[model samples]
Target: MNDQSEQERWNARYADDSYLFGTSPNAFLASQRHLLASGQRALAVADGEGRNGVWLAEQRLHVTAVDFSPAALAKARRLAESRGVEVSFVQADLATWEWKESSFDVVAAIFIQFADPPLREAIFQGIRRTLAPGGLLLLQGYRPEQIQYGTGGPPHAENMYTAAMLREAFRGFEMVSLVEHDSVIQEGAGHHGVSALVDLVARKRA
Candidate 1:
């Protein structure tokens, strides 16, 4: 689907009075929270409904949540308000967003899927360029094997990720952790129950 169509689809999905992905950080991120540095600027890309972004803000990280859906951004704002935390929301397509270089101390990407190889490469490059020296990146996404689990994730196998894919994407970075595992995700209607996923944490060399 084109960017506009994709945005519209997500907007419609989130337009209802339901929290699609629930109000919590990804299981992998929450598990590794101790490894994250405090008081650093963080960016949450494709942060639909602001769950993870709001959680980051609550952790005292300066946060900016970016997504193409205004509906999702509106819900994100509401979530931030309820949590009594501040998070900057940017409505833009990640494929075209002018990501800044060396600007963020941490970049968190959870469940953001892209089937187009070029677009995926571009997004990964953007993530790499947007990180500050010694910055860290925390990522979690469904693996192709997830189709068997039938829990959640994109229908296209190409949209799914693998540890090898992430290792190749962030080749130059210091890989702190990279693994494919099974875990129970209790997000909401969209993401729930047992899931097959790849999780990674990499740091930019200073």
Candidate 2:
């Protein structure tokens, strides 16, 4: 889809008054508290409605949250304000987002399974290129098995992640943790049910 159409699609998905996903940090992300610290420059990729971004800000990190939908971003701004946190919210399609090299100390990518293979590769590479040396990446997403659950994420199997796929994509990074499991998650109407999940925590080599 073109940028405008993609924007419209996401805007429509987020047009509801309620947050599609809940206003809580993804469980996988919140579990990695040991790696987070005050004053880190964090990027929350595709941070719909600012849950993770606002949580990052609450942790004292300087956060930049990016999403394509204006509706989602508007809700994100309100969420940030309500939480008494400050997050720099940017509306831009990830397909064409200009990712500055070595720009962020931490990157949080939670349930961003909206892309097909080509765009996914670009985003994977972008994450690698934009992370500063020794920076941490906290990523979680559905595995192919999630198609059976149908609780959240796109139905495309190719859009799902595998541990091997992620390891190879982030090969040069120091793998701090990588796990695959099935769990029951409740994050709102968007993601609620048994889920086939994969989590990856990697640190860029200094």
Candidate 3:
């Protein structure tokens, strides 16, 4: 898909009075809060509607949320203001974004599977470069089995992630934990039901 078209599509989804995904942190992210420290810099990739980013700010993590949709970023800012927490919301396509090396202590990427294989590889590589040494990386993506569940996520198997794929992507990093399982997700109208989940927590070597 064309990058512009993808951005426009997401913007349309976010062009609503309410958040597409309700204003709460992802389950995987909430579970790993203990790994984050107050005042640590965090980056929320494709943080549509700002749910996770706002939650991180509430946890006192200095968060920078990036997405391709202006409409989404606007909603994210509104969510941040309503929560009375400050977060830097940047509108950029992650594929081309100039990810600063060793800039963030935590990189929280929830469910962004819009990239194809080549772009996904670039994104994975950029994710590594963007984190500070020993920085925690929290990620959750749908597994191929999600197609059967029909709860959420892309239909293409290639877009889905596996534990082995994640392990290989961050081979040099400390694999704090990785798991594949099924869980009920009640985030919002967007994603709600029994879903196949792949959760990973890895850290850049210090």
Q: TM-score winner between 1 and 2, please give it.
A: 2
Cα lDDT for residue 102, candidate 3: 98
> Sorted by lDDT, highest first, which candidate order results?
2, 3, 1
Residue 183's C-alpha lDDT in candidate 2? 99
- Of the candidates numbered 2 and 3, which has the greater lDDT value? 2
Structure candidate 3, residue pairs in collision: none
- Model 3, 1-206: lDDT tens digits are 78788878888888889877898889899999888899999999999889999999999999999999999889999889999999999999887899999999999989888777888899999999999999999999999899898877778888889999999999999999999999999988888999999999999999
| Model 3, CA-based lDDT | 0.92
Structure candidate 2, residue pairs in collision: none
The model with the greatest lDDT is 2
* RMSD to the hidden true structure, all candidates: 1.2, 0.7, 0.9
Of candidate 1, the 10-residue stretch with the lowest lDDT total is 113-122
